[model samples]
Target: MKKLLFTSLLLVSSTEAFAKDITVTLEVPSMDCATCPITVEKALERVKGVKEVDVTFENKLAVVIFDDEVTSPDALTKATENAGFPSRIKS
Candidate 1:
C-alpha cells in the first residue's frame, strides 16, 4: 500500500511539473479602432490554456498568460491572426 501511494504521488507531481504558466506580450499593429482591443481580447481568450488576456488599442499590444504545457506563443499569435489582427511577439 505504501509503495502504491508513493507511486501515485510521484505521478501526480510529475504531471504537474510539466504545466508552466507563461506570460507574453504580442504587438498587434492593426488595432486602429476603439473596439479593436475587445476583438483581440476575445480572440485570445478562446485559445485553450489561455489563463488571461489583456489588449490595449492605444498601444496595440496584447498581453497573454497561458499554460505552456497546453499551448504556446505561436498558437497565441495564430489566434490573433485568425481574428483578423495579425500580431508578433514583442521584442
Candidate 2:
C-alpha cells in the first residue's frame, strides 16, 4: 500500500513539472490591412514553442498558443516586432 501511494504521488508531481500550453492575445496596432495579419501570424509561428497562431485583421489582434517551458510572452512580442509589427499584451 505504501508503494502504491508513493507511485501515485510521484506521478502527480511529474505531471505538474511538464510544460503547459498558454494562450496570449497580443494587440498589433500596426496591422493596418489584410496582408498585415498574414505577416503577424507568420512571425508568431516562427517563434520556438509556438503551437498555434491566429491573427484577426479586423480586430488587430494575434492569439498565440505556445508551450510555456520553451518560450515566453517576451519572445512572442519580439517575433512580431522583428516582422515590423510591434505588439503588446491585450489588456
Candidate 3:
C-alpha cells in the first residue's frame, strides 16, 4: 500500500514535467505612459503559472513566459485587458 501511494504521488508530480513553458509577445498598443508597463506587468504576474513578464512602454510590448498547462496566451491577453490595457499576440 505504501508503494502504491508513493507511485501515485510520483505520477501526479511528474505530470508537471510534461507541461511546456511557452513564451509569448503581446502588443499593448494603448500603453501610452511609462506607468502603463507597470500595470501590465503586475496584471500578468498575478496570473497562475506565469513564470516571467517583461513589459516595455517604449515598444508597447509585453513578453510573457508561462506554463502552458496552467495558462494560455488568451488568458494573458485578458489579464492586460482587465487592467484596462487591451493587448493582442504579436504577429
Pairs that clash in candidate 2 = none
Return the lDDT, model 3, position 54. Answer: 94
Tell me, by TM-score, which candidate is best: 1
Question: Could you tell me the TM-score of candidate 2?
Answer: 0.82
Q: Pick the candidate with the highest lDDT.
A: 3
Ten-residue region with minimum lDDT total, candidate 3: 12-21
Q: Write the per-residue lDDT of candidate 3 for residues 1-91, one digit (tens) a residue.
A: 9999999999988996799899999999999988989999999999999999999988999999999999999999999999999999999
Off by over 4 Å in 2: 1-17
**Tens digit of lDDT per residue, candidate 1, span 1-91?**
9999999999999999988899999999999999999988999999999999989888899999999998999999999999999999999
Q: What is the C-alpha RMSD of each candidate to the true structure, in Å?
A: 1.2, 3.5, 1.9
Give all candidates' CA lDDT scores.
0.95, 0.94, 0.96
Error of 3 at 61 (Å): 0.4
Where does candidate 1 clash, by residue pair? Answer: none
